[model samples]
Target: MNRITTAIAVLVLSTAAGCGTSRSATGGAREGNGTVTGIITLADEVGPKTGDFCAGLDVRVTPTGAPEEALGNRTVRVSRGRCSYQIANLPSGGEQLAFTVKPSPAWQCGNGATPTLAPEPQALQLKDYQTETRDFRVSCTAPSAETSTSTSTP
Candidate 1:
């Protein structure tokens, strides 16, 4: 069922991406512009979900040129521990799009104690009718020492 849901999401995104170019912040398309879809994979050297707390993530993406004006600061969301996150309908032929993985204490990307995105805001070029993927690793950090006890000792 989980795989089905994720697959559905990809389908929807692909459909949206196929319809043509993305509209500006004002909801208008630019001539000769294209669309781009981005994916953030959190599977690099990471453990399985294993019934861990699945936490959704918010991603912030901004089109390089005229960022705030054209594309604005758009935030995308994905299911908790979801391997693939699709950010679609971005304006192409504009500027290099920058992607930032929002931070969450519950999810750690690597061995870092702070649990932050390694490179941060992964960037890419936009193209029409195509999906671009960025590989990343994320893991849920251990709880505090107080919470590590498996049983209460009276």
Candidate 2:
């Protein structure tokens, strides 16, 4: 009985010691999933616009060079003014990701102008356990008079 108790104690101590060591001590650092978060803002030629200008818009994050059924694609809708979004559980290790904003087809600026995302789609490199921010600015500009004018014949 004494020998058995001694063996059990040794086993428990070894397990505890193993658990306390840092991941780097055993080998290289452990790879972990990463996250992407950011805010979406609505703007016009004058300045930033408030209220529901951002509502119903979507922000999407997709892994580049990934398979068709890859797991990293994510999309979130803007819920309010200065909307924020987060895409988690993305596989890390310096993977490239594409971030884009999608505006509703029926949505338009307060001045009856079309809105567009500035800087276009963004590309980012994600690292292990890292959080990346990619903010989006949706700018609305009224069409020029020439573009909106109607032609008349005598």
For residues 57-103, write the lDDT of model 2, one tens digit per residue.
66655556532322343545446556677777665787666655676
Worst ten in a row by lDDT for model 1? 30-39
Candidate 1 local accuracy as lDDT?
0.52
lDDT of 1 by residue, 1-154 (tens): 9999999999999988977676554576532243333444454444334453234455545655544543433334454555345555665664566656664445544543344454555566666654555655553354567655587779
Computed on alpha carbons, the lDDT of every model, listed in order, comes to: 0.52, 0.64
Q: lDDT (0-100) at residue 5 of candidate 1?
A: 100
Off by over 4 Å in 1: 1-25, 30-56, 65-81, 108-112, 139-154
